[model samples]
Target: MQCSSYWFCPDVWTAVILLILCRFRGCVSHLKINKYYTIKSEMAKDFPTRAENYAQWYNDLVIKADMAENSAVRGCMVIKPYGYAIWEKMQAALDKMFKDTGHVNAYFPIFIPKSFFSKEASHVEGFAKECAVVTHYRLKNDPDGKGVVVDENAKLEEELIVRPTSETIIWDTYRNWIQSYRDLPLLINQWANVVRWEMRTRLFLRTAEFLWQEGHTAHATAEEAIAETEQMLNVYADFAENFMAVPVLKGVKSPNERFAGAVETYCIEALMQDGKALQAGTSHFLGQNFAKAFDVQFLSKENKLEYVWATSWGVSTRLMGALIMAHSDDHGLVLPPKLAPTQVVIIPIYKTNEQLAAITEKVDIIVKNLKAKGITVKYDDRDTYKPGWKFNEYEFKGVPVRLAIGPRDLENGTVEVSRRDTLEKSSFQIADIETKIEHLLQSIQDNLFQKAVDFRENMTTKADTWEEFVDLLDNKGGFILAHWDGTPETEQEIKEKTKATIRLIPLDARPEEGRCILTGKPSSRRVVFARAY
Candidate 1:
């Protein structure tokens, strides 16, 4: 029952007071802005400035937009269709990759026995607070006929907990499946739901229930497990950069931030427009924790029982939040071509059935060709809405490329193509439409990744002193790259004061000579630190 009930408004006092005045005066100055966009956001203070209020901006975006809503239940969200569509696109892409990587999809029970969670001490402890346990099944009506509740007689001997992660339960079953070394490398990935109760919930960012894929691999040795972790991490990084068009910092989580019961945790971190960090994905090298806990052993060459090494990695619906903030603009979302459900959409503008019929006929031909090439194409022929309104709707939904065909195009043999990312429009001959649109989609994807990378490069700052570090975090805080002295105390101290933490120790951050900004202890290299999702 413990869940994040509400979020205290973290906006500045001046901004809050201004919104009050503007509400009555109809003046945006009260909201600290010059004018209003519509009504609510007009004076809402340009995303609260990442340096001044990073967390607030994230909250504002989630609630202001119709992406998602906080549920009546704590820590959970009611994802709107628009938001769910984005996640569906992400799932389609990642699922295809998993299948291509020699992995089989499977499902596991949502409720795990409470004792099953305790099999791995660290894992259980880490997730205990967030777990939702089921104690009773059936409830009987009271004599007063008020409300029916759980029936005590129907209770089971072992209580069930909503799974926070599936490692323990998955491994417990694997023991029965693995009889020899032939079943050593078990490649299985499951697209499922997980619950992790949070003290605070923000739409897709940290909801109690999220949809994700958990890839579990049972390897014969530690080396194989490590290899699998790195491989999947790379796969995630590649997909994020190319398919989702998001630039990410692939890195290893520090011991404190690492996944519970994992030897090493690899992750991909993306910087949002708010200059805060979001962990887009994580891969863990779980040496032998689950294997030993579940007694999953194999007979080696010498006939001795040897523990199996395992790896589990995942990326969740939270990536939808990251994607929205990373590339989306004031208008709405901007989807990359690969992840977009429709690579191209044809909106025919017309005044009559003759014109409409002509447009639909030609659009049908174009769609046929696009489909022939295995491209996803959508044709909007709804007449109830005006072409302009439809344009705005599709733009908000982030269709990668929009193709417009008017009656004039029929005579001229040309169509207008617009890219959602850049909002750039171009005219093309009808014959060249297919090839050009394909090229434009690829170009848009590349441009988005490049833009994200450029932002990350520019926002990353290096601080040599504690004052400088704190100042940067207070002012331009994105990713503060610096030496950590590699201690937990310093990490805690920084987070307490600034609400920022070591997001990750990047995989590519080269060794450098420096002193810890907080501890003044000797250090070798810089790690990425930021306020994170």
Candidate 2:
């Protein structure tokens, strides 16, 4: 005899046995299943490989790893707790660096008077397209009483522009703050959110609203302002390389790519795993442009009144996107230890309560010791999910290190350790486990940075002619060092043809004579070019 539910029961006898068991156990009541099974092996089946679809793989990994998701509002995202935690770590580290550099934190109004923007013509022109304006202040009930409507009677006499970038408004305020050379070099940094009405947005990469830190400084001399600009660029490079474990090339932007109204723009560009470049951070030397526009005059030590020299520099949440693209793998994120919120996770494998309790006791000691060493550790001993499920969760989320111990291991006084960067696993004695893990975390951090450095070195190449440049960009897709005629027209033409732009002119670039790859005109030095994010 055969059962009607053949999938569940292969024979009538099996069905009878299940029914009898159900009578006593109530079927599903005693059986526990993990809620995240969908994201485990089941979702892995549908996960796109990086080579198959790099963009889709990134989108899927962010969502699957519980990092972030698209919000209801268009061109915006809801960063999940896990994602925000990582961001918080970045913010804390950066804030310390800013304070160490003689910059004090301050706040500025989010709504700038429309007239303020008009003071700097080029600044306004650069951000005009992305500004969000507030016209009316109050909302009133609809006449039909369905919903609220903008109150026509309450319209503001002067329109306000949402802060896309804070140059205009900040400079306007500086006019009143600077009266003498003693008041010069007002180094202020603001950690705040700004809105830019972007038409196309990607999570953490480009969004309508984002959080950042902007530093605005006033100097009595042009040399002082230029020094400030370069100092901040170095700060950004240090944070990117040491904290985030991303290697970057320090350089200056071309005239076409310079920040609007800036005399010079300095930047750090990083190479991603997909052979694309990302501008990790930027600093701009305003060179008295904003001060002159807003009439922010300071009395110099020489007893002459003159416009103050200015510098403004910033780094935003876009670094999150860079971190993801640089180190994550097809399985999920391969986070560096310095930036991983949970640097280490410990799980216990057990079939019975007694066994679990024994493992937990040993894990508690390890956790305390690791925390004393200032490590962020999580000991997940939830019984609702099996040990295997938790292992997959930590692996996918990119916890730098993981440890598992069971009754057998407890008896043997050993634990199995696994590292996310290499997916390498080994058994180790439980004695001095915390010391081993601390060393291992540092090893992982160093290993990840070295791996990225190796990748960038292999991907970067030189192109001496137009054919070589185009071929490298089309097929090779990394940094292409090529000659340009040092003209905006030639740069624009190159972009129109190949969809690639100059990433930067290396700061250390020597004066090598060559011909422009496109125009065959005389050129000074080779600039780094690539298709970018």
Candidate 3:
């Protein structure tokens, strides 16, 4: 039998492994000494500027800011504590909104029986390429090799697929729960991780596994289901604008882009700093498709049996990517006040331990007052790092506000306040520091949103002719409002030529007579188009 023992490795190979790890240890020690500051400094030296390359800037910021890192598994990421903390803030805000909309949280299984997938033909077709299937029940040591292998004798009669989405399993369970109209309008949501087996992945943007909340609601009629869909879309738009401080366009997806198994899909799209569009969130009007597929029937008030109408809406951690690309600058992340894990970081400046102790005392009082006013504050009094270094670190991490207190400031009864959004610094009196910080945070949030909106408006342009559209796409690279022939053929042809997809047709688009940019066919209204992440 071949040995599975690690000690059986050839001496040369073992020596090579040890040499590599020894080199890695030195690098890791350097990184640990300065923490993220070392990463930021290295990024400053080696990474491309945001203007030079937005994609590289993004990857660099995600890593240097300690948001996330690529995992050992291909197409996967490990969200660092800081990143997960921001995600928790998002979850908390969205959870409140979902609960306010009469939706209750529920848990769903991660694995779906293979049979459930085939029930929805369109869904299976849409997700088939990305599905991760589990074919065997057990693994055993290989008789002829060193490592374990699948146990053929333990293979199951049916395979299980890791959930790409929970619709099939949820609807199958709904059939048993909804026997009467009283059970109609069953609003449930689940916060879960899903696997999509992505071919290529980026941290929060397109990972193989990501965290998200999926809301599935049952309705008595198509009208009710449609209303639920729109309501959830509004919720997402509201959250995006108010909490994330990112303005979004509320729109309907083109037929070619509608969600799988959905009759109509509604979404809120946000323009990124790079002029690309990112889908912040989506709500789908399923319109009885899932119900019909799973035979989820309900008895009506008139004693009639009918299939239930359905809707599903979701927002994922991809919003983290959206937030980053929408508002971040060349320095690093520019997190909104509401979503920042630590909204304010206070650093103490001093030459001696005595000076540090005195500054800490004042910082404690300020922190207490700030916390009382619902501000998340972190006091960095660690003697290992100087105050200037701490300031740069927090700025890179996108803390909305930073307060610095020195011995001179203690005598003056003031603190130097820095706003991350504008990179502006000012001195504020300690008498009402909490109130000042509160207003400053709101100002920073508003400033970031307004800045993004202005950038989007300046970048957006209307193109009446094909030449103009192509020029804008090649040069300006923002949203192009152009007419379409309302045909999939035209859409596909434009995408093939320009690599720009119809991000959406604005819900509020006015009717107009024009020609399609690509085919010059008669068109009714314009749609938003952009190259996306």
Overall lDDT per candidate, in order of appearance = 0.79, 0.84, 0.85
Error of 1 at 131 (Å): 0.4
Question: In model 2, which range of ten residues has the least summed lDDT?
Answer: 14-23
Q: Could you tell me which 10 consecutive residues in candidate 3 have the lowest summed lDDT? A: 23-32
Residue-level lDDT of model 1, residues 1-533, one tens digit each, is 11122332222210110001111111111111111111222323354433334355456556555568888877688887767766787888788888888889999998888898888999977777677677765445544555443456666688788788999889999999886787778999999999876565667877779888999999888888898899999899988988878888989998878899998999999987767788999999999999988899988767778889999999998888888777766555678888776778889999999999998888998998888877899999998898888777777677889999999998898898888887788889999577777788788988888888888887789988888987877677578998888988888887777777889998887889899988889989999998776
- Arranged by lDDT with the best first, the candidates are 3, 2, 1
**Winner of 1 and 3 under lDDT:** 3
Across 288-374, the per-residue lDDT of candidate 2 in tens digits comes to 899889999988889998999999999999999999888877668879998899999999999988988888999999999999999
Instruction: Write the number of the candidate with greater lDDT, choosing between 2 and 3.
Output: 3
Q: In candidate 2, which residue pairs clash?
A: none
- Can you tell me which runs of candidate 2 are displaced by over 4 Å? 1-43
Instruction: Please report how far candidate 1 places residue 381 from its true position, in Å.
Output: 1.5
Candidate 1 error regions (>4 Å): 1-72
